[model samples]
Structures are given as structure tokens and as C-alpha cells.
Target: MNIDECESSPCQNDGTCLDKMNAYQCLCHKGVEGAMCEINRNECLSSPCKNNATCIDGYDHFSCVCLPGWEGELCDVNIDECFSHPCQNDATCVDGIDSHRCVCQPGVSGINCQQD
Candidate 1:
């Protein structure tokens, strides 16, 4: 007697099974792999981020979120907040993490040396 492979629904993880000649084919889901769709693909396995950026894995995809003082698609670019010289009155501009600190001159105060 020819036993039907698809009768018992041997496919797992919501995979679809196609019966062939004395064999079967398992069509796995988006994030699933392997013969019976038993293995879940690891989205973070390739280390998609650069420059020490954090990688968040998702369904069949991943995201690279830059850390402080960094920006870009891969977080490989350094953000320079003081490039525009935000400090006024000759105040020193000290670049910080995702921000800048204005070292005001003598008798000067406030973030951009706007106040005494």
C-alpha cells in the first residue's frame, strides 16, 4: 500500500508539504529553515552593524541603531556637534556624546555663553 506522506501533515512550524514520488518537500516560512522547517534563522548571525553599533534582529531582517556620538546607516560615522561652532563669545566648544558643551570664557556662563 502507498502511504500518503501529507496525510499526517509531517511539516512543522507552519511549513507546507508537497508530496513527491516516494518523498516530500517542505516549504518553510519566512524565518524558518531546515528540512521540516524546524530551524529558525538567526538574523543577527552576520553582525550586520559596524563600528560597534547595536544590531536588533527581526523577522528575516535586522536593524542597526547607532550609539551615542555616532550616526549613519551602519553607525560608522562620528557625529560632530561642535562643527557649527555653537559656542558664542569665543567660548570653547567641546564635543560630547550626541551633544556639545560650551566652555564659556571668564565671567561668561550658560550653554552657549549667552548669559553672564
Candidate 2:
């Protein structure tokens, strides 16, 4: 097949089978984690953390858990600096917890609707 076809092959989310070199490589996705990328890494499978902790995905590894008002694959979900609360005086909302921003009204300020 072609490279595009190989890249889009249904070799599983974590495993990748390349036909060029007559071989395959495992490029694990965010959640799934393993040496060969064969094993489905269940972030919530093990009770590693205490309390109703949440598992967060990481670059190479994962975090233990997250604190209150926090979320993410690796508890990296920080407080949205531009949440709704940041808006003022009928201002519109702007950036959210993640990397999202909102449109502002005519008399709004800041990256989003901060002031008017």
C-alpha cells in the first residue's frame, strides 16, 4: 500500500504497522501506554492514587492524580485564566480552561470579553 494508507491503517490506536520497511512500530496514543504499545494503558485501571483521584495523561508518563477544581490526563488542567469570571461589566467570555478563546462584544476588553 501507500504511506498514507499505512499511516491510516487500522493497526490499533497504539500500534502502527508500516509496510515500507516491511515492519510496524507502536506509536502509543495519549492514553494507551506500554513498552511495545500493545497493552492498553488504562489510566483508571489501577487504584494508585488516594480518594477519588483522577488520572491525567502526560507526555511520556502519567500523573498520579489531580486536586480539586482541576482536571486533565495528567492533572495538568490548570484554572482557565480567561474563564467566564474574568469577564466584567457585561463583558463576553474569552479563553477557556483549555486553549480556546471566545469572541467579545463591541465594548469588551482583554483577549475576550473582559470589560465594556
Candidate 3:
């Protein structure tokens, strides 16, 4: 009959019962959610992320963000679609951000110093 007693009563796994003056409320935990916190909530239904970004769900909330080389929800894969040759035949190699530059010798035109 008492709210405190009800809250302590054994309900079910992942179920937290909150007793009120006239009624009771259940705060469901992971893998469980609903009016009484007795139903299971499917995370896939929400499609929380946008632009193909990944959606990582958390307690009572969720997170959506894109990964490197990918910029959409679900983290849809994409192609970098780029190439570079930084090393010269006579000179050394030099790496750069998103691209590479060649250190040509005294008389080199292309990377790897193939031409003069």
C-alpha cells in the first residue's frame, strides 16, 4: 500500500519502479522502455544520425557524427579518390596534408625526379 514499499518490491530486470502518492512510475533501464518502462525500445527505428554519420546511442539520448573520409549518417563508405607521388628520382620524398609534394633534384620536372 505504501509507495516506498512498492518501489522496493521486486518487479523485473532493467525495471525501476518509482512510487507516487496515488500512482507509481517505472524508470526503465537499458534494453527496456515504455509507459511503464516495460517495453523494449528499438534503436534502429529512430535513424538518429544525418548525412550518413554514425549514430551512437546513450542513456536517454544519442550521438550522431561523421567519421574521417565519410560525411553521412550510418557512416556510409566513400572513396578518397586521390593520388600523389612525392619522391623524386634524385631528391627525397616529402609528405604533406591530404597531398604529397616531391623534392625534385637540380633538374627534375616530375615527382620521383624521372624527367629534367
Candidate 4:
């Protein structure tokens, strides 16, 4: 007389339960694990986000909250402030970590080389 151990749906988080010899096993689904698949896998464990960006975990996925002067899916891109042409008066723009430098063409002045 074998009592069905899987009679009761004890598995959680969409886990598959396999009845064994007076025991049961739960096969966790994607992005989940634990005795009953109750734990959500931490996608941020690997630090996928770049440049001090915050990592948000999701169902089998992750997202990055980029800091100022950064962009892209993984926050890997350094925002080019020069893209908007902040440097006026025809200055050479040099990209930096999180900022841009305007090399004023001779006789030009001001923070953005806007002055003459």
C-alpha cells in the first residue's frame, strides 16, 4: 500500500513535484530555487550593471538604473554632454568619465568656450 506523496500540491512558485520513495522533489522553474522553489534568483548577484548603476532584478531578467552622465541598457555608455553642443563658439569637445571638456579655439573663453 503506497501512499501518494504528491497527492497534495506542496510545490510553490510553479515548481514541478516528483514523488519518490516516501519523499518528494521540487524542480524549480526559471529564476527560482529552494526547497519549494520559493526563492527568486537574484539577478543582481553578478553585478551586471556598470559604472555604479543600480541593478534591479526581475523574472528571469534584470534592469539598470543608470546614474547621471550615463546611459545604455547596462549603463555602460558615458553620456556625451557635447552631443547637445554645450560648447559654443566652435570649441573642441573632449569626452570624460562623466563630463566633457571644451578646448577653446584660441581667444575663446568661458566654461564652455562660449566667450570670445
Candidate 5:
């Protein structure tokens, strides 16, 4: 009689064990790997976050948490600080990654170039 190799239940992590001639084969479940399905696949292994963002692992996916001055799914976009027209006195509003800068006209001052 042929010995049943799968009788010992060597597979792990809910894997299915199949008996072979003289060995056993383990069919791993989804999101798991290894000879015995002992390793759980890390959802955040690919580093999905961009621009110095944080990556959080989930059931079968990952979340990219944006950092300061960054936004979007992968945190690849820089925040547009000058979109609201913060500058005054006809000053030029320059958008930057961390903050916005106002290019004041001659004799103009203050954070938003409001003074003249």
C-alpha cells in the first residue's frame, strides 16, 4: 500500500495538503506563501507610498498616507498653497511644496505682501 504523505497535515495557514508518491504538496491559500504556507504576504511590501509618505498594510491592499505638503493616493502631488490667492497688493504668489511665498512689489511687505 502506498503511504499517505498528506496524512500528517504538514501544510500551514489553511493550506491544502495533497499526497504524492513519496512526498506531499501544499497548496497555499490566497495571500500566503512558502512550502507549508507559513508566510503571510505583506500587503505593504511594495512601498506604495511616495514623496516620503507612510504606507499602511490592509487585508489585501495598502494605503498611502500623505505627508505634510503632499496629497493624492500615492502622496505624489505637492499641495498648492497659493491656490486661494493669499498674496495682496497685486503681489505674485509662488506655490511651494512646504509653503507659499509672496513676491512683493517695491516697498510692499508683510506675509501676504499686504503692506505697501
Candidate 6:
């Protein structure tokens, strides 16, 4: 009835309360939705990421930051670091997390097997 009801800030979490005819309406912030703005919306409820990536909730949405050895919008693609053939001296190139490993042959050594 009176605006004083909303003045007391019945809404929680910094919600804005609008006084109505004998009642009040709470305008909740992002990620919060309810009659009294007490419910927290799960941003990751729909599993927005692919390839088992982690989802971090944002203000009104979410972010899918891909992990190592993975890339793309949903982390569905595996990065091939050995595409350029970084290994030398007949070494084997193995793809790794944001990198590559050169498995040296019988007589080769060093990172890319460049040294004998």
C-alpha cells in the first residue's frame, strides 16, 4: 500500500523493488530471477560447451574457455601442433598441449632432435 514498504528494501541482493497497489514487484539483477529475487539462475544448466570443456558463468551468459590441446568455439577440435613437422633428424613428432614433442631416434637427442 504505502511506498514505505519498499523503502525498507524487502528485496535482497540489491534488487529494485517497485511498489504496487498493496504489493511490490522485485526487479532482479542478472543471473537472479524470482518473485523476491532469491533464486539464482544456473548459467551452465544447458551445457553450452562441447568436448567436456568447463563453463564459467558470466553476468547474463557464460564463457567456454577451451583447455589445453583443444580449440574452437566449443573446444570440439583437437589442435595438431605437429602439422608443421617440427621434428628433425628423422624424429617422431607427437602433438601435445599447445606444443609438440620430438621423440628422438636411436642416435638423436635434444628438443626437436636437431642435435646428434
Q: Candidate 5 at residue 2, lDDT? A: 78
The sequence of per-residue lDDT tens digits that candidate 6 reaches over residues 1-116 is 25556877889777899988778899999888888888778788899888779998765678788888788877888899999999999999989777899999998899999998
lDDT tens digits, residue span 1-32, model 5: 77998888999888999988888899997778
Quick one: ranking by lDDT, best first?
4, 5, 1, 6, 3, 2
User: Comparing candidate 4 with candidate 5, which one achieves the higher lDDT?
Assistant: 4
Worst 10 residues of 5 by lDDT: 54-63
The per-model lDDT (C-alpha) reads 0.86, 0.55, 0.59, 0.90, 0.88, 0.86
lDDT of 3 by residue, 86-113 (tens): 3647566654433455677776777456
- The 10-residue segment with the lowest total lDDT in model 3: 77-86
How many Å off is the CA of 64 in candidate 1?
Answer: 2.9
Q: What is the alpha-carbon lDDT of model 5 when measured against the actual structure? A: 0.88
Model 2's alpha-carbon lDDT is: 0.55
- Kindly list the per-residue Cα lDDT of model 4 for residues 24-87, writing each as its tens digit: 8999899998988889999999999999999999977899999999999999999888888888
Clashing pairs in 4: none
| TM-score winner between candidates 4 and 6 | 4
TM-score of 3: 0.35
Overall local distance difference test of candidate 1: 0.86
Flag the better candidate by TM-score, 3 or 5.
5
Cα lDDT tens digits for candidate 1, 1-116 = 55678878888889999988777889998988999988878877888788788998876677899888898877878899999999999999999778999999999988899887
